[model samples]
Target: MDVTVNGQLTQVPFGLSVADLVRGRLPDPRSVAVAVNGAVVRAGDWERTQVGPGDAVEIVTARQGG
Candidate 1:
């Protein structure tokens, strides 16, 4: 299925969880924030939160800049 990630179109396998997505991209998934379909998903829930097709995923990493 197709989903939008950080405003880009991307294809992901079915039954993909938020954790899986994060792990695939970032070396430190815990240092980022994730939102799916406009709802912020808690870090603890990432492992169970499944991203469906057509869902908009916004992943932002925390930067240490003023």
Candidate 2:
């Protein structure tokens, strides 16, 4: 299936959960916060959160500052 991840279009395997996409595929998953289709998803919910075509996903990570 095709979905928009962090504003970029990408293809992922069917039946993949948010947790799988973030932890298994996406680089540096631990440092980022994820939102699916405009709703912020909690870490505990990732396993049950399923992604589909045209879904908009946002991933933001924290950065160290002086």
Candidate 3:
């Protein structure tokens, strides 16, 4: 299946959960925020939230700056 991730089109396996996606992309899932189809998904729900094809996903990472 194809979905947009952070503005880029990418292919992912079917029934892929947000948690799986995050773990595959980032070293620390704790430092990132995720949204799908313009709605924010809570951290606790990541495991149950599945991303469907043609969905828009945005994974934003936190950065410390002064």
Best by TM-score: 3
Q: What are the TM-scores, per candidate, against the unseen true structure?
A: 0.95, 0.85, 0.96
lDDT of 1 by residue, 1-66 (tens): 999999999999999999999999899876799999999999999999999999999999988988
**Candidate number that wins on lDDT, 1 or 3:** 3
Estimate, for each residue in 1-66, the C-alpha lDDT of model 2 and write its tens digit: 899998889999888899898886567777778899999999889999999878998878878998
Stretches off by above 4 angstroms in model 1 are none
What TM-score does structure 1 among the candidates reach?
0.95
Alpha-carbon deviation at 50 in model 2, angstroms: 0.6
RMSD (Å) of each candidate, 1 decimal = 0.7, 1.6, 0.6
Writing each residue's lDDT as its tens digit, candidate 3 over 1-66 gives: 999999999999999999999999998888799999999999999999999999999999999998
Error of 3 at 56 (Å): 0.4
Assess candidate 2 and give its TM-score to the true structure.
0.85
Evaluated against the true structure, the overall lDDT of model 2 is 0.87
